[model samples]
Target: MSVRRRASSVSLSRYARPGTPDYVTPPGDFCNAFWGLGDSGVDVLFARMRCAMTTTEELMSFWKERAILEERYARGLADLARFTIGKHEIGEMRGALDTLKNETAKQAEAHLIVANGIKTGLETPTLEFLRKQQQHRREKLTAVDKELKMKRNQEGYVVRAREKYEADCNRIKDFAAQSVLLQGVELDRLRIKHQRTLETVQANRRDYANFVRGLQEATQRWEDHWRAFCDGCQDLEEERIEFLFNNVWAYTDAVSTVCVSVDNSCEIVRLALEQLETEKEIGAFLRTYGTGNVMPDPPPFIDFENPDLQYDPSQPPSSHPANYPRQSHRFPTEDAANRNSVGSPTLSINARRASMTLFQPSAVNGRNGTARPPQAVQGGGSIPQSPSSQQRYSGGSNGSHPSHPPHAPPQQPPPPVPLQPQPQYPHPQPSNLSTPAPAHVPTSALATAAATAPAAPCPARTYTPIFFSLSPVQAIFGYTATTEEEFDFQKGDIIAVTATPPDGWWSGELLDDTRRQPGHNVFPSNFVALLM
Candidate 1:
């Protein structure tokens, strides 16, 4: 009974225990029963699977969207690359065009230089040749005239020699005829005469021989000299002609070279112009793309008017105011309010005359119209009182109170006579001329004593106090002795120092160690010493 009761109690306790499986319920069956309710549990599982599938589909759609964007980005990148390549190509073409234009221009310039050189070379030789030819012609003509004059003189000398020879021969012939007819006393006389005739004949023959010899030598010399001169003249003429011909040839060659160079230069210029046109076209094209419009053509020539043409003196002058009045035109009458506002003199002619009357006293009584006292003219001339009169007149005219009466004449003060100092003369020397002993010793030895002589007390060395301020930091470091050091002090610091010699005091900073601060001494180091 106790065991059954214990068993019953254990059973009851086991049955009463919470969450214990009942003996009639199988675990598999219970699980099968709960799972078999497809309406709720299977619906929840299907819903979870459907949500996960939807998420996967959304992920796939997102990937597709990303792919589309990536593709579009790739296409854009390709387009940009193509654009960059196109720009690079365009730039390269432009550079090539510029280079070609520059090269063409350079070639044209070089051709022009060569052409100019050729032209100058051609012209210079031609001009020189012409000058030389003209000079040579002049020289040849002079030489020919000189030679002709020498020939004429030689012919004259020849004629004179022939006349002398003929006379001598005639005299000899007469003496021979007389000798043949003589006999007796005549024979003796004839013999002496014959001897005389023979002597005379001999002398005549010698003279004739000398004359003939001299003539022959002169003729030979003249012929030889003339022949040599003619030969020289021929050679010179030939050389000059040859030189001219050669110069002509050289000139022609140079001209031909210049012509050819000019032709080539023209061709080069044409080509350069074509290149320039092409470059301009390229520039226009580039500009069209850059600016979205064609550029306007520049004017062929600037229209400038002559600056000197603006003034036409031939035309009558404008009918403006002639000899414009000194007073303001706005105030036409003296009674106008603006009349005095212009500050111009409003006195009438009679009023000016009346003012001049104030000088009657000086003009009547003063010498040279000067009102100064007679003694004031010590230097032999009178001082003019015109300036004084003018001063008084001007003062009265421009004074604030225009209605005041004219100033009375000032009384002339007596001129001061400078007292001439009497000339001091030395006392007459005594016959002995004895010197007196010196009473004072030299002061050089007493310099120290003089320096120590209290300096006349110096009036207490008075100094005016000028207060200065300094920051706490600056006070710690002490005041800067100079303005430069003060300026260079750290930001928080302040400087205070007494500036001496207080009159007209000014201070400025020093830029460098060598630069002196105002009223300060620059030292060898970076320091500046204040000067009192």
Candidate 2:
């Protein structure tokens, strides 16, 4: 086995002779021979030693300086990372730096292997080894490039996420601004509606106060009339009793009989007193339930074309006769006459004929529903008036006009008169109740008139396209509702209109039952009307 000599031990003769022009000195041999003992003496030796020492000193100083530079660079890098990343992210950044440090150490080890192999080579430079080392270095460089691209991708994800968050924040702020604007508009509309309601309430209060005053006056007048009638009856009864006592025997066959007749008259007077007391109770009821104008004189006939007339509570009913004309007949039209003939309030020819036949029971045939004509009274005594006609007679005269005296026999009573031909006069015509007005009339007078009339039946719940004007009273009718969702109000309740819908319906709330909870309900507009 042979060992290779150092480059300085290589033969000079194999290259070229010293004298030949083609000869060249190798650097190591030339450097060694120049410092050999045969050349230049002590001065040369000193210079060579000093150069050798200087090279050694420079080599040691390079390594020492490199270590110091590396330490300073490491400290500067740590300070720079802390300043940029802050304390929270500093730990994460340190971990990444540690990974870089490990990779750099691996690269350094690979470079050291390449350097050692080059130094140990004894022949001509190993080109294959150098090529392999270059290839390995290129592969390490590619790996470092791939790691850098991976870190860049991670950073890009954070940037994209931040952009999305910023966009969402901006959209939220815009929505909040839009919501604030819409709420402001709705608030304004509610405020205007509230103001209108307040005004309506004030007007209603004034009308209510006026109604109360009128009711009080009406009550006072009725009380005065009742008191006067009672005083008149008492005075008349006292006078009659004095006259009867003075001529007791002349009037009847015995004193006991005269006394019995007087007792019967007193009993009739007691009944009259009871009727007057009943009327007094009715007056008290009217005061409590009355909410409209007190027009006891009479209800006016409503004409839509005429301007509304105001009801003045201060004026007496007698003063307003021109406004409310008395009807010539109880039923204004002939149709009304025929319709009411069976249960009519006032006497007519048919009613009188029926009455005349009643006193003569012998004229009526049993169960066959037939009657014979009544003959005139045999005596001069007058035929008795029916209960309907009795309403017109004075209180004291009613008892004396009885057909049969308490002591007289039934056989001796007066006979009935034959039926007389009824006199005919033209009947006053009533306006068609269903006709709609062409334009809106002022509500004040119409409200009073309707309130004065008896309540009418609720109109049918039909939807139609007809247009009409409605006074306050004309718009107040509602039906007796069976269910809560329907127009649930009393049969004669007055509904207050709040709004009208385009669907041919009106939205209203019940005002008649004050205790009922208030709520809006819809009803067909055509179904509602004033009492008139």
Candidate 3:
């Protein structure tokens, strides 16, 4: 193939001829023939290259969008998995919920893996390729344009030389025509001028031919360089297509791998689900919430009319009230006669009662669970007052028990009825023992009264004078608890003064109340008035 010169303009017939189907054909099927077209052709070549670069850019954008999609889907799924609400589900249902949550998280991870693969294996390389191509295209295009400018300058020089040669040939013809119409001297001068122009025309013709040859050589060199550029560009375009095709396979494979991963992830959830059953859950529910299935039997009825109750010693009671008495809620009991006995306090109320029993010296026997009257003596004797009672009376508080002694059994006993009466004195007593006496009578006055009254048979006494037993007393005034350990009571309340220790506080109980509530607290000594 060769370029042909024309009288008017240059022809690019050589490159325009059809060539092999490979190489430059694919890269510039429309632009390679225009390589000889100078600046205008440069525009065409770069435009084709730029289109290829644009395609790679578009591929990169596609990958970016896909990455974004995968990333967002992963994030959303992760949020859904993590945002589990309440735990009302239990047992098997709870396990199922957890499995579902894990399944969602696994799916999210799969999406994320796809996203990461696309970003690293596809988008990043495409983007880098675009950057490199863009740079190389610009560099190549600039070099091509620079070479084109130099070629244009050389072609211009060739045109100028051709114009000068044509003008010189026209002057020689004009000189020859003038010589035929002139005289000897005039004709001779015209010939001389024509001869000089002809020589100058020959030199100009040679210079024009040289300029044409030089331009042809220069054009060939320029075409060679431009051809090298196009060939290299074709190879680059091939590389771009090959790279893009491989990446397409990678993208599809990554998406398909997500399916495999999802299948694997769901397998875990399936396994968890397979283990659960409604029956198992129901059994657990029953175990958690079951009550008894049988009703308890109600107590049997009894006939009140001549009702015969038989004592059934089905088994001995765990304890008997007569045996292990309660300690905290009741005043402590003691055996006055057995202080040195095991498990006994050294000093106690029973001890006081034992040391202070009041009776006729002739009567050796005294009160206990059963009261035996003092045996009567023929001689009249003084009624002895209990030292404990005097202490209670002198202390300005009512007596802890009745001052009356049991009546003598229709026997020979006479007495000086002196210190106190059998009942009406303000001496405190256990109300359950017998009919009670006036609660506020002064003991000293009662003693005087009893000293004059006829010695009528004393009322029968039911009081068992067990030593250390609680002796009932009456409170003349109200008392309130000031601390957690103190007891509260109102006026006219009957209290059993169990102890009158040296400490001002004394312990007792409300014997008058229905419950017979005991006072665990120690009260002020002055709160009650003992009989004198």
Candidate 4:
């Protein structure tokens, strides 16, 4: 039986007397019988039965004696159960307390941060600085406003001045037009007066010239008649004195007529002189009238019919030939001058060929008797001679023309000139073509030196046909992982390997126990081998 059941049966035995009906124990009284037994009684029974007793009489000797002991035992059992329960409660409480403590600490830290924020906000000077800046901005705005107002006032004044200037311009334009009209009228009047004065002067000069011519003719006639009268007086004086007196009277009449003519001539001459003086004054006045300075003398008169006045025939053709007929003579025909130009020396074909041969002895002679050298034409070197020249030169006899007609015999060959050895001069050979001998080195040593000379480094080699290996997991993921330990391997671990030396380095992911989705797995679960 279990220890508690055994103990309870023994306690019931101690509480009951032997052979009693309670000792016999009815089926329903079994629980009560076990409850009436004390813990000491159970210990005693266990001792008498030689069973090991975990409870003792000392344990049952408390207040209420056996009953109190029983109560105490029950209380002890309840307290132990309570203690075991409290241990689990304490563990749960401790976990909750730890969580609460962490939350509290976080809250405390947050509060400290808030306090620091408040302190920082209170300490900063930005608001005061902003206020000063706003005041400065207001001052600048006020200055700008004042300047704008001044500018507006100046612009108003400028507008008023422009209006006044426009009015003045209009007035000036009207005055200028009126002044131009007045000036034209005055100029016309002056011109008319000048023309009238010019006509009067011309008329006066003509009248004066006629009057002078008449005076001269009358004077000459008077002198001739007086001389004739003197000669006649000597012959008629004795024969007829009375007739001589009448002749003298007629002579006197003639003399009086001459005197009257002279007086009329003198009056005409005086009027002409006065008119001429008036004309000169009028001309001077007219010349000074409009011009600011005295008028210059008119150009000297040119004769229209003089040889110098005639047009020069040697002048170049005029651009407007229709207006100037003399230029038509310059158009001469080329045919008219060609005969004169043709007499000048020009090369014939033979002459040109001869000249070419003289200058270039190596030129190929053509059938037409023209020597055309192989010209160094552009885009290439000299042109090749015709194939006939090569055949002729290649023939055994130099004087035999290969293409000549059968009737023509071969010409005799020129005699060979004797050769003389030229005097040789000791000249240095060019260094590039003439290799220098090695300085006293043995042949074997020279060969060894040549063999030992370092050759240029060969280009770096590259690996080809590379192969890769993957772990089992990597094969599922279509990727491979590099092994962390060179020798160790796991079934699911990824291993990135290559057959060829890696172009740079091999790198891949590592696989752990963590499960991953298909296609998401970066590492191989098992080793995989790949062939290139």
TM-score of each: 0.25, 0.13, 0.46, 0.19
Report RMSD (Å) for each prediction in the order shown. 61.2, 62.8, 41.8, 81.7
Q: Any idea how many clashes model 1 has? A: 1
As for candidate 3, its clashing pairs are 350-468, 393-531, 396-530, 397-529, 397-530, 397-531, 398-529, 398-530, 398-531
Order of candidate numbers by lDDT, starting with the best: 3, 1, 2, 4
Candidate 4: segments with Cα more than 4 A from true spot: 1-89, 92-102, 105-112, 115-119, 122-124, 178-492, 495-532
CA error at residue 218 for candidate 3, angstroms = 1.5
CA lDDT scores, all candidates in order:
0.35, 0.34, 0.56, 0.31
- Predicted candidate 4 versus true structure: per-residue lDDT over 148-237, tens digit per residue: 344445445555555555554554455545555665777576556555655654555554555545445543443343234323322222
TM-score of 1: 0.25
Candidate 3 clash figure, as a count: 9
TM-score of 4: 0.19
Residues 89-137 of candidate 3 have per-residue lDDT tens digits of 6787788779888888989999999999999999999988898797777
lDDT (tens digit, per residue) of candidate 1 on 1-532: 3554353331223323356444435422221221222123223322332333333344334434543443454454334434322233343354444444444444444444434443454334444544554454466435544654555565666567667666656766776788788767877775776576667666656666676666566556545544454454445445545654664466455446544544454444333322232335567667766554334444344235766555544855333223444564653363243223322122221122223333322112122432223112454533211111101011122121111111112222122122223212112211100112111111111222223333321122222222231101111111223221123322223223322111101122233334223223111110111221
Q: Which candidate is the best by lDDT?
A: 3
Candidate 2 per-residue lDDT over residues 216-294, each given as its tens digit: 5543543343334334333433443453353333323332433333344333333322223223344555565645553
Per-residue lDDT, model 3, residue 404, is 27
**Ranking of predictions according to TM-score:** 3, 1, 4, 2
Task: List where candidate 3 sits over 4 angstroms from the true fold.
Answer: 1-43, 174-203, 274-276, 292-532
